[model samples]
Target: MLPPVKKDRVITQLPQCFSPNAALHTKDGFHPQVKAMCQFQRTATVSFNIAKVIVVGDVAVGKTCLISRFCRGAFDKNYKATIGVDFEMEHFEVLGVPFSLQLWDTAGQERFKCIASTYYRGAQAIIVVFDLSSVNSLAHARQWLEDAMKENDPSSVLLFLVGTKKDLSSPDQLSQIEQEAIRLSEEIKAEYWAVSAKSGDGVREFFFRVASLTFEANVLSELERSGSRHVGDIIRITDNTDGHRRRKRTPQCC
Candidate 1:
């Protein structure tokens, strides 16, 4: 007899926070609404639940390293500038529903800014990465965010301020930058996180957190859209002689 098909493995637990104040949500698990929706659609598969996430920041701020560390589980010390953009697809199953994230690694160079800006539209999340040890990079975070916001709706996109290379920052430096980062995060309404790609500290947790949050948002959005449509019901539109249109709702006939 043929063996049964194997299912793909995915994360189950909702990743907890590194800092509650700078987190997307302080709760330790998935929201109740998301859980309830999962149960309601348990037998059906949610295809195309992909959240487009764009990573932007000053050049050489370890954007590539951060993404690579989490997605590929490898950290390369060498720095080669990203030309225009790069892409990675990471999948997850949140509350028994399939979800995925399209991680867009954008170039941070001045020359490539124009090239990268074109891909900023329709992003569900924006991750602004900076080197923790470099105060200059942190200072430019706002401008990068501003550039990214040009193509996306501020109210709809999730913002994340990430401080990379945490291992290289001294205690005093780290504390100083962290205070500023938290302030900036609050100002921009972005979540703050510190990670070391080399050590893999906070990398997995951060991405997991991103995946979970994005998945929840996607599901909630679907619920909102589908909420308007009722099963076995339809809308009827009638036109008046005065050029006005009227609508009526009626149940589908058997």
Candidate 2:
């Protein structure tokens, strides 16, 4: 049986376009609230979509700090190298759907690269981080990505180029590095974002973006696999007593 989902931090503040009261789909064809309770009881048995994210970068590039800020809402300045790998799980409600992310922080040192590389398999998303104030760290991002991608399906993985410690970089420095980062992002076909783990700037937004993208991709994949209906497919419900008919379709949530 799968382990119970521990109550951790919640990341539910979606954009204004997404309705908080949006309808959610249940497997047993019941109300969402009702299903939520039942789902909670069978937490050990319920199978839900999980997005595995791996963070990689050069040493002291703020990978752990970024994860700390997002997972625990705190940052530690005491610099310590990761031994091999660290794990964190985050639960989120996106568009009225429950989704989880398994975050893996891999060691960035050369000695731990081999050990950390073993944990990179079967990752759905890879976040390559670099220090915004250190051009050399940014220069080594390609290598970090290459190492992490070696064990996973490159085409199937979603990539994000992240610049950490944004608060420490000067405006001119940030602009120059950002341009180069953009160029590299396009070359590597990955999304790019600048964030500061220490100041908690763009950290939440970055993870929210990851959760949203991963959730959408999973939904689309399920739709394709089912092959019975396409996204936005509608169904009609009729009222026989009043001779009235309305189009209503079940919401898709996975």
Candidate 3:
């Protein structure tokens, strides 16, 4: 059975680092031009209620541990690398509506790259995890993101740069690594988060933020696809006295 949805969850807005206009071109690919438009009004009913979230990064970066911590509330001390790809379904209640998120964990080894990359398509959110104590892991984030973005529509996918094993890094070391992580996050336009799976620090917050932001984005995209049609635009009424007249007009927004 899946975990129950938390009703007290409150996600007011997207983080400051999130930008809907961020450049989403993959490496060695043509950058598509996109035009910005004013925010359209959303209907009461959401067209999409499911979101797919993919986690990608280098080996031994704790991608599995992070997901386990969020989903099962437990972490494994044994280090077993992911083989190809694994997934888990998480339920959420966003803005008083029930929603579902599919979390995909891809293998970070080169041997499984081909198999894992095949599952990257149609992802609603991509999380790139790195080891805070390993600088090399941080450097490879760009390549991982490129591989995943190549199979997805970059404009529609939300990106996040996560640093795992926060408990292993010293305060001084963490500060230095954070600077570099911030620079890379800005370059890729992905949100930055630091968490310790073993200690369970910042794990819940990170997942909640991801779920909320993706939910909001999904709602907005559905509204745009619906072409400005508001909910309850059509209505019917009858007059008993006249019995032959009909009237209709677009409902006014209050």
Candidate 4:
């Protein structure tokens, strides 16, 4: 596991999820309530040591593109493929809790198959992305789901079905194809979402939904740790070490 924080603070407990929702990946699939990112208030970054994430998908499904947009807030239209796994990090505060996401975007081609397993280890969340235009990539979600489940810490690991490049697909086609993909996500007890990295559609939502889920998981983990061990001077709000380095802003409490 990476260092809990780039620098561990003397403070004890951190704040909990500011979002009111209790769970993610419901029977309805995509969340209708999360209209925009749950942004934080302006404060000095106080890094909290927290969760990790992994992004998985078939080649050309916009996995790397999604990370680029989310982490760097920039996009590239070029088609250079990821050789193995592309990496990026972002620090943000949620519900007054500072957190960092070490996002690993993996290669989807068959030649890169062996590398996926190694990357999947110790992942707190797995995003399985598929192209809305390709039945083959959409169908591949099954394999991606199974491989993610192989890691098997259901409570800590989140499995999400991400449909990429919605801009290229006709509206009818996008909805029709997404319905089928969401059905599969449901079958596997996962949530489904559509995004267009090029157009900046659902890209942030896709990641924020995962962050919300991870936020809940982190709170629970912290609670468990607090109960099991005793600590003093705990500040409810905290930012991760990497978060401190990534962003200077602090999150507001709900």
Worst 10 residues of 3 by lDDT: 30-39
For residues 1-254, what per-residue lDDT tens digits would candidate 1 score against the true structure? Answer: 11121143265768887777877778777778777666655555333356889999989999999988877779999968888888776766666655567788888889887778888999999999999999899999999999999999997899999999999999999999999999999889899999999999999889888888887876667667678542111111112122221212222222
Q: Cα lDDT of all candidates, in order? A: 0.78, 0.69, 0.72, 0.62
Clashes of 1: 0
The TM-score values for the models, in the order shown, are 0.84, 0.73, 0.76, 0.73
Candidates 2 and 3 compared by TM-score, better number: 3
lDDT per residue for candidate 2 within 3-92, as digits (tens), equals 343344233333221111221111223334323432342433333456788999999999989988987789999958787887777766
lDDT of 3 by residue, 1-254 (tens): 22345554434333333222332222321111101111111233332256889999999999999999988889998958887888777766654444566788888889888778878999999999999999999999999999999999988999899999999999999989988988888788898888999999988888887886776676567556666554222111112212211222222222
The numbered model that scores best in TM-score is: 1
**What lDDT does candidate 4 reach at residue 26?**
35
- List candidate 4 segments past 4 Å from native: 1-47, 228-254
State which candidate, 3 or 4, has the greater TM-score.
Answer: 3
Model 3: lDDT of residue 254: 21
Superposed model 2: Cα runs more than 4 Å off: 1-47, 229-254
Considering lDDT, where higher is better, how would the candidates rank from best to worst? 1, 3, 2, 4
Q: Cα RMSD for candidate 2?
A: 14.0
Give one clash count per candidate, in the order shown.
Answer: 0, 0, 0, 12
